[model samples]
Target: MTINDIAARAGVSISAVSFALNGRKGVSDQTRARVLQVADEMGWAPSSAARSLAEAKTETFGLVLARDPHNLGVESFYMRFFAGLELEMSIRGYGLLLQVVPSVEAELAKLAKWRNSRSVDGIILVDLHVEDPRVALATQPGALPTVVVGDPSLAGGLTSVWTDDAESMRSAVRYLADLGHRRIARVAGLAALAHTSIRDAAFADETRALGIHGELVRTDYTPQQGAECTRAALTGAEPPTALIYDNDVMAMAGLTVAHELGLDVPGDLSMIAWDDSVLCEHTLPSLTALSHDVVAFGSHVARRLFAVVDGAEPGAFLDSTPSLRVRGSTGPLRG
Candidate 1:
């Protein structure tokens, strides 16, 4: 409830508690962890009014999603990732300020306002673009501590945390190739996203190297678009034998589309999903998927932001890739 209570419970000096709670220097990491743990156990929260009067640290991190708000709430990966980010930030006595904007410029403007007003201590940037203006804005000298989520190449010198999407893409294509899937179609996420671009290029190169016909169908990360893509793919004169989707939502839609078309999953049509979620398991024919710990990825990104706030240098780091998880939805090419 109070700092005194936390100090007494933590068995540390009140000054130590103050330093740890304020994100200031002069406390050992162990001591800081102890103070925070005790504070959380004692149900202590810093008063916003009190924070304003002190050293000007808002103790908050900013995250902006330049996507449709409707989808973010329902998307399993983002939902889980957000939970992980909030968990870490809460343990560190920091709040998360999340916003959704429709345009890149608007997102940049919001970040600027937060910085100018000192409304947030740091920020997490996601979905790096091929020619991202946010990169330059975020990586400038004396800029706010930023952790960009995507490939390091897109970050323009800021701290970046990325998964090995290129390799993962290659692995997916290779897996299909091994299953005798010569004609493959990938239902990719937004075209402008750096990760999507990476996956596209890797998929093309890998397919070419393996002597397979690979096509990429772009979408806006919507189930409708996914269904449309699947319908088009299946109705083509030379339909692909195997299909890969960028997310579980789209993959499930694709599966439904296959069923609607009178196709047998893994018998006439093989399918794979990018992210492993509950949806992947609930389908009549469970989806084979490229899976990884998305929650852990979020925690890693959040910790990188904290490190940057603690004055660590900006650099790129790789998170774990999506490992292939074969399931009922994928099988050898069938005539």
Candidate 2:
């Protein structure tokens, strides 16, 4: 069925049907309902692309990430965060257009295309870096309404929601220090990610404050990389008495590597991780780390995006504090 069929059944012109279906203001309430009923009866649906052009609002948001779809399997944080975003967006009557691109330029192209074609009303960006171009583009005049989900050190005029990653990292390191772990090692995420840099700085600060020896190693946020880094840290001349990892996936890998090396968790090398996941609970010794409601983070960011789209004055960017979750993976340092 077509718009022409619905127009004929509703006793209105095709243009009137189009206006009603697109949520444009030219149609009366009665006419809009009649058109909708006829369209529903005929099993007809309006084209989103066409409706966006006619209504001047796409009612969609673009989500750009820099990872392959298959890599999502191990990243529990993103899956859970996205699920929360989808849930909130469903209630708010907005659709998400998610795209994965290899480079920042590719992501920029996708956003530009969406803007030029009127395919999205706004956008939400993840996986940010220092001095990211997306930050500048998002703040440009007439650019799509944007909400970013990483470091808040962005160009002025954009809305951002993030956790206090540096503070949380310091807290984790202090916990180990208070437990009398002098030799602590950090398994960091990608070197280029601003979050990783923040964490690294915080780790260094806390270790120095406590007068403890510290080491940090960078990885690609993959379990394999985490395992490899864990092995190297364990086999060092003076191995770390405690290990802190950037994410739960890498923490699990560290646990596996520790077991292969015949080291007892907590007893031989204590472990802590960021971003709590189900895998942490199932490990031989449950992992302890900084934890927060990532779902809430995603929803909070989405709500902020909606506020921006609704023309709210962009105020200070929001940051959530992370709490420590104690589990079996850490213990009193062996004397």
Candidate 3:
């Protein structure tokens, strides 16, 4: 219904009706309440387009993924994360504008376009790099409000929500060491991602400090790469007694590789996967994992972005450190 109808029924001036409807300062509280009640009675609803134009807000948030689209299907992390993000967005009657690009340059271009057009109220930045140019762009004057999902050090003054990847890596390494795994190997995700490097450093430091042999193999977070890495590590002259995978898909691939090689899980080689999921539990030998609430992590990032959009000072938030969950895939070393 039109504001004119509300003004006529409420016996108020059209301007008074406008002020009350928009919560502007011109109307008295009593008039505002009467106007609102009458409008509700008449089933009046604000036009989203008109409200957006009046407020200079699109009422939408943007997310850009610079990765292979195929990976999105198998990776449960992003699916769960999106579910959490949607949970927050739906409560506020907002929408998420998502775009997947092949490279960081394309992602940067898309962000610039969104900023120039005022198409989104804010943006969520993910998969942060060690020397991310996006951080510089995001910090520039007039850039869109941003919440980075990465280590604070890499966020470059933006509000950030990060998990303690380094500490989690150390904990996982120590867990395997305590189980008499003297030689261990890790199949890691992209080396360029900031979190991967942090985990790598922690893995190396913890393994050395404990006098354990540590090996690292880099992958693209794909099942194929995971299987290849697992095969190579297992075939080496001094194969590791324990292995860690960067993602559940990779860990599952490693399990298949172990089976192919006729190796008994937790008996011949111990294994642990990161980002625990339902797949981990249903495996032939249930997979041990470094588990955390990834969906909650996404929700926290959305909250931080909303805070930034509301003009709060940029800040860093630690979501949680992933804790080890022992299962059938890991055990004390037996030769």
Best by lDDT: 3
Steric collisions counted per model: 0, 0, 0
Q: By the lDDT metric, which is better: model 1 or model 3?
A: 3
Clashing pairs in 1: none
Candidate 3 C-alpha lDDT tens digits along 97-170? 99999999999999999877768888899999987988888999868889999999999999999999999999
| Model 1 lDDT tens row, 46-69 | 673254324235678888889887
Clashing pairs in 2: none
For candidate 2, give the lDDT of residue 182. 95
Candidate order by decreasing TM-score:
3, 1, 2
Residues 1-335, candidate 2: write the lDDT tens digits.
44545666888865577778878888999999998888788777457426533423456778988776667677798879887787788885778888888878898888878766657767898888888888887777657778888766753557788888888888898889888899999999888777888889999988999999999999888999999999999998999999999899899999999999999988888999888877888898999978888888888888887777655667546557887899999998656
TM-scores for candidates 1 onward, in order: 0.85, 0.83, 0.86
Q: Which stretches of candidate 2 lie over 4 Å from their true place?
A: 1-56
Name the better of 2 and 3 by lDDT: 3
Q: Estimate the Cα RMSD of every predicted model relative to the unseen true structure.
A: 7.5, 7.8, 7.4
